[model samples]
Target: MKYSREELEEAKRQIDSTLHKLRETIKTFEAKEEKARYKSQITLAKRRVKAFEIANYFIEEAMEK
Candidate 1:
């Protein structure tokens, strides 16, 4: 399905907001006294951040097209 430009813009905004929150979460995880406790969660969040970044890139490319 083809999305309207407005919809694509909104999607990008949402992804940006999510990425910001995820980064904050990673920071908070790292700041813990026992960093090892959050290691798995941190790793998962980092992977998610990367995946979202790729998704956002694709969205931008689609918008360009």
Candidate 2:
């Protein structure tokens, strides 16, 4: 499928928003005893961070192309 520049820009905004939410979630879960309860949340945040990184990579690649 082909994407317009505007579409990619919107996708990038969504990825950034999701990453921001994940970061906030991680902060909310930051407590010594709640670590166990928040393990999954932390993992999700990690994955989101990775996805953010990958999204940025694609954005750069496409811009370069």
Candidate 3:
């Protein structure tokens, strides 16, 4: 599938927003002592970070094309 520059830019923006939200959630979970909650938040944060990294890689690839 082919993506326009605008579409790629929008995807990058959404990923960035998701990353920011995950970071905030992690910070909030850090203040609590619920092990399950903390663990879940950390897992989500890691996933979000990974997603953002992947999105960035795609953006770079798109730019190079």
User: What TM-score against the true fold does each predicted structure earn?
Assistant: 0.95, 0.77, 0.74
Best by TM-score: 1
lDDT of 3: 0.81
Pick by lDDT: which candidate is best? 1
lDDT of 3 at 55: 77
Candidate 1 vs. true structure, TM-score: 0.95
lDDT of 3 by residue, 1-65 (tens): 89888988888788788878877877777777775757866887878788788878988798679
Candidate 1 or 3, higher TM-score? 1
Between candidates 2 and 3, the TM-score winner: 2
User: What residue runs in model 3 are displaced by over 4 Å at the alpha carbon?
Assistant: 35-37
Which pairs of residues collide in model 2? none
Q: List CA RMSD, all candidates.
A: 0.7, 1.8, 2.0
Per-residue alpha-carbon lDDT of candidate 2 for residues 1-65, written as tens digits (9 for 90 to 100): 76778888888888888888877888878755768887887887888889897987797677566
Task: Order candidates by TM-score, high to low.
Answer: 1, 2, 3
